[model samples]
Target: MPQESSHRVVLMVDENSNPFEMSCAIEVFGLPRPELGRDLYDFRLCAAEPRTRMRDGFFTLSDVADLGAAEEADTLIVPNRPDTDAPRAPHVLDAVRRAHARGARLVGFCSGAFTLAEAGLLHGRPAACHWMWADSFRARFPGVRLDQDVLFVDDGDILTASGSASALDLSLHVVRRDHGAEIANHVSRRLVFAAHRDGGQRQFVERPVPHIRDESLAPVLTWAQERLGEPLTVADLAARARVSQATLHRRFRAQLGTTPLAWLTGERVNLARRFIERGEKRLDVVAARSGLGTAANLRARLRQETGLSPSAYRRRFGPSGGEPVTP
Candidate 1:
């Protein structure tokens, strides 16, 4: 990993690149955040050519740097590359492979997962790709384990998103990872975007009907989120949903690609994370509010979810002024 003082991110673009995905990366990592008092990332856009028209012929980008520019990047992002089945340009594939060999984080947005797959970076790894291309991707790269359900997959160094919008989710996630939730939330708020989304969320739900009004789980979800401070069981969730426990389980699996308990635990962890970031020094207070029951349970759960202890997490991401935030 590059030193935090000078973290660099390079956007790898090509003739077939989707302009939307390229712009998404720029919005998250390229633009200067004056509110933060310093540039969060050194962002650059690179292509194999000096200048090239995007996938759509009407727009063109000028003075583009070469793929070699990505050699020193802390993170190398490949935006949506149009064709999933076609072989990637040899030079493009080589540059990605070389960068990965040197420990640079690689991000594949949407069909750009194909580029990483073509370069053999995703072999034997769980990856996410646009749902429409999942079958073709599996057929083309049988070595890759593609999960179409999730919005994105962050496997330490190699990150991949399911589709166009998930690119934003992944980008925000990278910001949250490198800096902290505070900075990430700042960027999200500035863009009027949702601050953070768990990568495990479904890219699209397969509802039986067109409208979600009557069958909507919104009310139950709201209830659950509000009561995250209390111990919640699957039975409790079922009662709140006004459905059988089995039905609730089925709905969660079909719609969320996860169990109800898993979702609840994740929410509790999220609550704890926010509490810690806001400078809640008392572990038991944080734990109780987050519904983890006690400090011991909070420590184990936080470590499992975030790989950090309560104290360590607070120290790393706590509020700058040391003034505790009011609930």
Candidate 2:
């Protein structure tokens, strides 16, 4: 069991702020993980005012820490209110600015981007917001590169999630980046959520009107997972689903916002990474078992995906790894 973390995460709750996003942040960062034998973050929630009404006046919050709590944060989840156009509290924006200037990592969930934009922290940077607010966000803050379709954007010091639920996605991604795939997976499993969905994947994919019965990929995905050690191909997956390769490809794109081959490659990469983190020393063995075929391919893929070679990854995440080096 590791010691409790020193990393502080401060969430800003303001008038009319959405509670759903707040719960998402708390679920991910606030809850202590007894399973891991320690808490992953030193989490706190702060409000600029002594009393505040939440979104649609669903509830009132009080007795939280003062806005000054953000000053001590290593990561600051910014204030988000329902009225995207309404100006944030001047003091709240100032606090955000201070946190940014101090180099604290900032996160904006949904309309929270408006707060960061108001604070001048997102200028000339990529951000993601709910699709409903995309047009307004772009028109008002053209300088901030708003990726209207992505689920989230991880821009090093600043991050943004497109919608309320996607806040969990961004939080899990942060865990993966800060800890590693293994810890992130454990957290996701605890939440009963998918471990990963690439930030670049479309958050809102439009579907054509259905002309035929819709089929699910769950069975086929499970089938493929059990056979990842075998040399798998799109054709093999298509055969398992009893569908044509074109249909398989179409379903993968429409449902997953990715090609079949891309999904398969990602799974293999994750498998290789898991093996290394479990203390596999021989890169060639890890590659073969993960179906990547060779150490050279493992090296190229691991570095491309994780920015770390097999040995470096193991040294940082394997059994003997006392603490993971910050990425």
Which residues of candidate 2, in runs, are more than 4 Å off?
A: 206-214, 321-327
Instruction: Assess every candidate by TM-score.
Output: 0.85, 0.94
Alpha-carbon lDDT, every model:
0.84, 0.88
**Best lDDT among the predictions, by candidate number:** 2
Clashes of each: 0, 0
Clashing pairs in 1: none
Q: Scored by Cα lDDT, where does model 1 land?
A: 0.84
* Model 2 agreement with the true structure over 154-261: per-residue lDDT tens digits: 999999999887899999999888877878888888899988888878887657456766577889999998888899999999999999999998888888888899
lDDT of 2: 0.88
Name the lDDT value of residue 157 in candidate 1. Answer: 96
Task: Name the runs in model 1 displaced over 4 angstroms.
Answer: 1-5, 208-212, 219-227, 231-255, 319-327
